[model samples]
Target: MNAGHPIPGPASVLAGARVMPVLTIPSATMAAPLAEALVAGGARCAEVTFRTPDAEQALEAMAAHGGLTVGAGTVLTPGQVERAVAAGARFVVSPGFDEQVVSRCAELGIPVIPGVATATELMRALRAGLDTVKLFPAEPLGGLSTLRALAAPFPGTRFIPTGGIRAAHLAAYLADPSVLAVGGTWLATPAHLERGDYEEIRRLTAEAVARSTS
Candidate 1:
């Protein structure tokens, strides 16, 4: 274990999942129910972003639930890496590429997917030994067309487009082998999670899975 870190790398985190629902934990109470509901809907994995103070607790809560894979998103610092791994996060994702964060995650044995919006950032991530990366604010970065263009030079790289993705965009993205998975909040909106609407979460997850795989 590098630096005493124990979890496997990012490939394990992806786990062939078509959708990695980006989630915000409003409270610890929302973690387990949301995890169970996501698994019930066929998306057995979830990405709880470190966008709030509740993130660490929520990551811990979701990781405890059986049969669900939990990841930490919006990770930006070595401190966050230590916190996430301590909280049982198997993987970490950042808004933009940061060598320090990626290196820290590597030492801790947690897989990381850093965001890259251009060839330069992609090259940097690739140089960091990351074959897969997230495209931040994916739509404004040019969406699938942009992704297709970016991938032309790096055929072996895979992407997890995280921003602005909707149910309608899933099919096209998944159809391309370069897209490992799609991440977004639309699958489990804050409103649904806040209201404890697990059924809606499950239903949306199921449709997303179906659409992506179909």
Candidate 2:
């Protein structure tokens, strides 16, 4: 992750966040309060996934809320990259690394953590000048051991593992130095957002943070 640029790298975007909440908003209304609650829990960063129609508006609200390192997730297209930045996203993430999407983001100067599942995809990321990446659906992809094996080859790279990760599973990932951070949808689930359970979300976030830091 390069640092001397105007936009921060994945390292900076992910810094101080042991577990980043992967959020999907049902509407624009839930953005601010959700960000505030996560901030209260000591995690200042959140990934607002572009999975719903209201995602862009929600990202706009969250980024404008201030104090949060707001990132756009599930971004799959170059056009979405444009929209994400337009909506105030400080960083962008994709399920898989695409040359077009990455190049577009580079043109815009926004840091992107593209998803890679194999050595082949990782080589592409390296060629694209990316030092950090996301290991999507990590649990299904063999979890910690798999990452360890992958890291053995690309020692300079850092990984953020996402998908199907539970609170009980945070320690194993964080214990590895190659893991920059863990991104989990379990931090603030659809149920929590739908029910407006900021308290539970905060509590869960706090618990995860406490454990990750300890």
Candidate 3:
């Protein structure tokens, strides 16, 4: 995180991106085209997960595309946070909460949405001045039922539920006022990228955008 360049708030980022496409790019070369396809389909933001060897390079490429606000996902360490910010990530998302990672992002002035599946973790995030968090493994944790339960006690807290979410689940998730957005890998599957099916990717993204808005 650079002291001179502050990232946008998570609320602002998610507000514009009701359907945040979570991407796992295999190579740097595919990043720009993927970004272009997503943007052409009306996506405002995306997350490049650090699950592949070229994750950072891919993130850099997507960020350079200049259309969608790109961020780093699956970030687990403070070191990865620094790398993600250097690669032009506007935000950082972790599969779970980490005090060190949160501190590092705060030090760099980057918005971070750490995952929380329990009230204890949610309390920790709230105490740290974070009102937004990701409800990880959302389906396995009980889907909208779980989301409603967690959000009941915290009126102003916002959530961005991710994991195992599909097109059919979008409407129900977004219908909750507590949800800032939804993150999913369905928009750009690995097969779509492997086959260089940018059109399919574009169509999926457009369909998601339509679902989120409608």
Candidate 4:
């Protein structure tokens, strides 16, 4: 949240991108190439999750690559929010809604997308002035049917469904007008990164992008 570098709004950040690849980098060294592969394959945004020790460094590398709009995901605390912003994260995403984390992001002037699985959580997010939220574990939550149900009560709200989402599910999810973008790990799995299979990553990304837009 550097004042000099303005952060885009959540909707703007996700504009035109139908899929946002969720990445878990095992090593920082692979960050640049991974980002390159995704961008080359037509991705406009990505999320680097904080589930690994190399997350911060990897985020820095991806942000510096100057292609995809990079965000920090799996953030659990305000302290992690600060660290993520310092590492050049343009946006922040958490698995669940946390007032403290959202407040901290607000203080830093960065867009935060917190996960919500129920109307209660969705209400809380809307009350806090956030209309865009992540629908965590979307598949287990009943996928598109559940999303339609949740969106029914809040027409103005938008969703970015994540967790257990795959390429096969992309078209169906994106078909819903309420869905802003779909996030998934299949585009850049840990195994893909471990094997340095950037080509496969690029192919998957391209395929998903094509399917989403088509």
Q: Give the per-residue lDDT digits (tens) of candidate 3, residues 93-165.
A: 9999898898889888889999999999999888777889999989999999999999999999989999999
Q: By lDDT, is 2 or 3 better?
A: 3
Model 2 scores a TM of 0.94
lDDT of 4: 0.91
**Regions of model 2 farther than 4 Å from truth:** 1-8
**Which digits, one per residue and each the tens of the lDDT, describe model 1 over residues 66-88?**
66788899888899989998998
In terms of lDDT, the poorest run of 10 residues in model 4 is 1-10
TM-score of each: 0.94, 0.94, 0.95, 0.95
For candidate 3, give the lDDT of residue 99.
85
Q: For every model in order, what is the number of clashing pairs?
A: 1, 0, 0, 0
lDDT of 4 by residue, 78-148 (tens): 99999999999989999998888887888888999999999999998777768799999899999999999
Error of 4 at 158 (Å): 0.3
Cα misplacement distance, residue 35 of candidate 2 (Å): 1.2
